[model samples]
Target: MKIPFYRPYIGDEEIAEVISAIQSNWLSKGPKTVVFESEFAKSVGSEHGVGLNSCTAGLHLAQLALGIGPGDEVITTPYTFVATANTIIHCGAKPVFVDIDPKTCNIDADLIEQAITPRTKAIIPVHYGGYPCEMDRIQEIAQRYGLAIIEDAAHAVYTKYKDQPIGSIGNITCFSFYATKNLTTGEGGMITTADEELANRIRILSLHGMSRNAWTRYAAKGAWYYEVEQAGFKYNMTDIQAALGIIQLRKLEEMQMLRMQVARAYSEALADCEEIILPHDSHEHRHSWHLYPIRLEEDQLTISRNEMIDQLSEAGIGTSVHFIPVPKHPFYQEKGYRMEEYPETEKVFESVLSLPFFPGMTKEEVYYVADTVQSIISKHRR
Candidate 1:
């Protein structure tokens, strides 16, 4: 069978729970969402987890909760999704983009200090491709600069950096449950934090600053009066989405095992292919393997990277690119950034291809993708 780029693994349990939610008539943020939050926090070793509408909301809320605004700068990688930068902009702050480390496609922790200015308030390090970033280095820089750290953990559901889970150590961390991410709530997000004050503020900010939820105010024997203590956004996650998340989170470990196995297979099969540079592991860090991207050696291969993607599709294999440099986007261009500032990001953009990876893929399919890619490269090798 042709392999898909990515697909969510929804079992009958998901269907049953979704129906239960629909029938319960409490389709808004209610018991299920709260339960999902509790379970997720426990699994990821977080003190608290607040469910939201999207990872963008999580990052934006993190900024609001931390009092980051005008005249503040958040340092981040230019190699992540535009949302990472856009969230900082939403807070009326600027995002100072740093170049990514060429090997791991993560923000270069060593270079972050140079970007820190008096105006720099925080650093939002992304766990790219589920690979744990050098958090020790990142946190040390943050501490030295007196800056907060909010992790963009959208791709790192199960990742650990130096034995610490991504959400456990960051000042605040944001995650995505988009269809393409490891865990899908169709469209949802989470904010995990150890700080009690930050967690309380984020919970309020996500629910339109309402002192109490509608379920608390309007449900049986509930009070109707409440106060809006904070001006906030409507970032709450609906029970429907959370219902899916509850089931998805339960299956995460099983899903991750399959993903890692596929990654290992790819690494072993492509070890001798000089035209491709395989993904790397961080020292003493566990990768979540959210993405499997191979960098093509264009000169050694007769076909361009773009052409390889085309050929993969023709051969019944779907592929994608993790990202283009954030600064190269038109919006960022308007803000006066050139590709020359990020050498590694610019070079990697041309060579990278995100192969199909998901829990639903079978071992036979994995081999098929591996063999097909090698065959295609063998035909094109100069």
Candidate 2:
């Protein structure tokens, strides 16, 4: 009866891949990492991929590669994780926050142009909970203004925006392979782009800004000497992570199917419930269902969102919130970001609750969660 929030569907294949990586004795950014980068890029229909230690690293590198620095402004949503904004700060740029579209919980594309200034350099659109932003509108705006698009696709590995994969649309797209993600490599990330020069720059920046071929310098055929092109952080992915990523990438479709099944079950079970608003989905944009965040209609329920979370915990059903909004955080507040500016984000934050959703959740568990939620709502009805 104890259902945890998320349990990664790691199998024997992942373990075997790790073992193989360990046996190969080439652990640091070697052939396996290279292969994983290529395969992941191909899977998402991107021309190039650069593997890194984390999605944050990929985001940071994306900004650096685009020459976004001091005095520059990067427009993004206040509804996303702080990493999306933090990367902009790391590049010595200011993150201009835009409000979210309450329906999709993504940046309101209509509001983006108003936030743009002469200093505006790029747009970082986060596909919140795997539901893609309105890319067509965003793209049109970017093209008109000559602004770069960097997609924060941490929750959108398998997501598609109108038949075009998330990775292939933006100038640069970053994906996360954290433990809780649908496709996990324990802790890893990749950046996908169509520009070969950008890809090479990202690869070089990921590892101390060494020569593009420096990763292979220690190999049997590689030379011992290399030169540093720029001062970059050590953000390279290891062969071990890439080995696991290879198998995980291969199993992505299988895992995504299971996630979709669980999402459908939740929607079907709660379709009649007026006290909650289910996550958004559509035919044109394929949702990856990374986090099944449901919003409580607090006006109809006596219990608050936090109280409901406590109740779920008491019932042994683990739950979480997808995000707390970047502007609401203390760090961002100190930097002059105010919550009052993001009314939509604050409204969504007050009622949103992420349910226990994972690829391998059983029917019994799904029903138990549904029944528990219903029972709680019935007892707390106004």
Clashes of each: 0, 0
For model 1, how does the per-residue alpha-carbon lDDT over 1-382 read when each residue is reduced to its tens digit? Answer: 2789987789999999999999998788888998999999988898898999999999999998999999889999999989999989999999898999999999998899999899999999999999988889988888987999999999999999878888898899999999988898999999998887898889888887988454467567778887888887899998999999999999999999888888888888788889999887856898988999999988899999899999999989999998988889999999998889999999999899998988778778888888888999999999
* Distance from true location, Cα of 357 in model 1, Å: 0.4
Off by over 4 Å in 1: none
In terms of lDDT, the poorest run of 10 residues in model 2 is 211-220
TM-score, candidate 1, is 0.97
Residue 209 of model 2 has an lDDT of: 91
| Candidate 2 all-Cα RMSD | 0.8
Candidate 1 yields a Cα-based lDDT of 0.90
Q: Per-residue CA lDDT of candidate 2, range 131-222, in tens?
A: 99999999999999999999999999999998999899999999999999878888999999999999999999999999987988889999
Global Cα lDDT for candidate 2 = 0.94
Question: TM-score, each model?
Answer: 0.97, 0.99
Q: Would you list the C-alpha lDDT of every candidate in the order shown?
A: 0.90, 0.94
